[model samples]
Target: MSAALMALTGHAEDRTAAAREWRAAAKPVVGYVGADVPVELLTAAGVLPLRLAGSPRADDGAGERYLGRGLDPAVRSILSRLLAGDYGQLDGLVVSRDCEASLRLFYAVRELRRIEPATALPPVQLVDVLHLPHHTTTRYVLAKVRQLRATLEGWVGHAIADADLTRAVVAHDRLRDLLTEVARLRRRQPARLTGTQALSVVAATTALPVERATELLQRLLAEAGSLPEAEGHRVFLTGSSHDSPDVYAALEAAGLLIVGEDHDWGDLLFHRRVGGSTELALAERYQHNGPSAARASIRRRAAHTAEAASACGARALLCYARRHDDGPPWDFPAQRAATGLPAVSLERQPYGALDIDARAVAARLRVTEEVAR
Candidate 1:
């Protein structure tokens, strides 16, 4: 692999490494727990915005105690890390009320900080942007974005100017364009990259500094055409957003190439850029950009899934939802009908190894392919 690809993959595998390095360098680092948080606002405030990922392998007994066993596994893992002081170095933390589990996480962290003053939790703020596509909802989301900017300003001890936001927006737009190119490469015939590699690159973008991430993406794209082609059944993944590439890696190892996905961690993350340099523009863009399982209607989600699958030349669809992450699974039936393709629904899945018969899935997909032919 090229050095750029290697660096991005490493950063994705170790999500906190880059943030720790930045913190050590005396730079302010703020962590966000959901996709809805405006990263541009954080960037404009001159702090590193790191997206937190749960470590599925972590022994999070504390998380079980605080969050209980019924919550989403990824959320529990994140709570465990917070309780363990894994993010003690962060200057601030933003938790979005994008989904129920993440909202619960915000409440738990806030209460924990209030009761246990000795806990090393960073100052936390909640960005609650409602996704209803009405003018009232848009106004509400815009107000929330402004509040987030104020909170970030307080953290950095300075007002975030429009110039700063404009510069940040421009930088992020460039990053988004570069990522779009990478996505195009993934959809190429005889795929230029593996699903795992594509996912790693996406995850790394949120973990690393924007400039560094953009540079790495540029380097990878320059060499992507020459990368060895990946061979497998072209598949589209939907349902729960993936924090790690483990699932993609396993599925690809089982003879499937996930060419596209409609999840926050994948294509939906960069589906739209900040339309303008202002907070209202950012709020409007996020609120209206793409269908999210947490906020969008089932029909819209299904339509997006079908459109994305067709665009990527996927022969089949895989809908995998994690335990307690209920929103995505509700769309599966609609998605199955809309796509009109062979589909598999792996619902209530765990965070780790997936614990499914991969070979059986591969065999079934092969049979479906033959039947389609």
Candidate 2:
């Protein structure tokens, strides 16, 4: 692997170091939980926006006492980190109602703030954006976007002018377009990029600033292009948002190439630009954002999966979900019917424990691939 690829895989270390330097320089930093929170808004407010991930090594004991055991491990881990002062440098945090866990997290953080004032997390704000496309919902979502933009501006103590927002939008759109190019490489036959590589790039982008992320990705694209294509059964993955590349690594080990996916952390995040004033464009983009199993109707979710699978020319589809995450399973039946293709459902996984059953999943994938052939 190239240095860029290595850096992409070891992004957590890179992010940690970069954040420390950013803080030493007194740069305002904002943390966000979901992909739905627009980076452009934060950029316009003159703050670095860091996407928070659940730590594989974090103990949920501190968090479980407040959120109970029903919350997703990822959520619990984030809460534990917050209580432990792991993200103490953040100027503020924006949590969205992207799923039940996210909504619960907003309340849980609020309660934590009420009870523990000293360890107070940076002011938390909820960015409520519904996926519904009705006019009423559209107006509501636009209003929310405007509200968030104002909130971020106030938090950063910067009056984000129109020019600042326009520049930020351009930067964000460039990042999205570059990622789209990388996705195309992943879709190539004898795939130019592995699932693990694709995922590493995605994870790294979420952590790094837009300009730096785009630069690294450009270098990565060049190196990946010259490499020989890989041979494997092309598979489409649908499941809860993956915070790590464990599942992708496991699938690749099983002789499957995850050419595409319909997850928040994947293709669903790559979308076209909205044309208009910065605020209006942000709202319009948010209103038409792609559907996720957690929030979209089952029919829409199934349609999205089938379309994504077909677009990538995948031989089979794999539905992988964690034990506590039930959203994917709820949408699987409809997706199976919609595709009418060879499909395999992996057993419920322990949160962040993809290695434990990787061999079993690979074996099942082989059977599914053979059936498809």
Candidate 3:
């Protein structure tokens, strides 16, 4: 692969670099708080979809002061960065509820707007999407989706034509298809790439324009295809949306290749595609896909994770929970019992270096190593 292609897959590793690249494109970027925001809709509306993952090196002091320290560290970091003008150039921001911290982030940002408009927060919108697949849920979320579309239309001062949405869906669906191929490689007996590398690709795509991301992914897939297969204790990671590759890097360093993860930031986000190329079809498909942590029962969540682990040939399961991220703990017991795999769970501070938790890493390494023995 050429140097540019290599950089495309690894470039989002640095938040500053990613932001600079996006800004250089000079598009009207719409920052999102979580993975649930529909990139298709944003793209159709001529806005670049940017997920607001705070810089890995950011301190949570400003975020804690505004939103309280009780929030997840990653969430706090997002708040800190937004308040400090890290994403000041965004044309708008959309916050949705895939988790509690995201919802809280939305509210905090709204309050911040009222308290001080000079910080250049851009326009912010809250997308209240219902997570379950019930009839009422679909209807409610679809309406919200339309409302969100209308909100964006007003901002852009033009109607998003059906053709535009169709094109957007096709583009996003193609991107998802390529990512699925990457996931297939990750699931191989000896993984085709490290979990950190796989995730870096995912993270990079989220920050780039759809066409650019797709082009980069195609090159990445080609590059990974030529590499020798990896060798390690194959593991399935669960819990927490990892914005940085540190956790995956740490796990891989411990002789575990993360073959799969049940986090939204990983397999969950890329596993599914929009069923149809229309707005209504896209809305329905997304709402009914499966319940995220905020919407599903422990049993449902556990079942999903266990099945994914089994499908990926993971010999063990590991979960790393950040402080105040409560959903994972609730699902752990059932997930462990259901999977019947060697398991390790650990606690870490938000955005803290995952590899630095010596005890947790040691315990996880021990489990994988023992299993291999």
Better of 1 and 3 by lDDT: 1
Candidates ranked, most accurate by TM-score first: 1, 2, 3
For every candidate in turn, the CA RMSD to the true structure comes to 1.2, 1.9, 2.4
Candidate 1 regions off by >4 Å?
none
Return the lDDT, model 2, position 206. 79
Q: What is the C-alpha lDDT profile of model 2 across 1-373, one tens digit per residue?
A: 7667777777743455556667888998888998778778888887877888777666889888877888788888888887887765788889988888888888988777788788778888999887777888878888998899888878877788889889888888888898998898878876888877887788778777778888988887878857668777788988777877766876788678889988877888775565555676787787778788788889999998898889888888888888678889989889988987688775467776673566666678677667768
Query: What would the per-residue lDDT of candidate 3 be over residues 221-290, giving only the tens digit for each residue?
Result: 7677576677777888887778887777776776778898987778888777887876677777667655
Worst 10 residues of 2 by lDDT: 12-21
Cα-based TM-score, every candidate: 0.97, 0.94, 0.93
lDDT of 1 at 211: 88
Give the Å shift of residue 242 in candidate 1. 0.9
Indicate whether candidate 1 or candidate 3 has the larger TM-score: 1
Model-by-model lDDT, in order? 0.88, 0.80, 0.78
Candidate 1 displacement at residue 286 in angstroms: 1.5
Model 1 agreement with the true structure over 157-239: per-residue lDDT tens digits: 99999999999999998999999899987799988888889999999999988988999999998888578888998999999
TM-score for candidate 1: 0.97
Candidate with more favorable, higher TM-score: 2 or 3: 2
True-vs-predicted CA distance for residue 205, candidate 2, Å: 0.9
lDDT-better candidate, 1 vs 2:
1
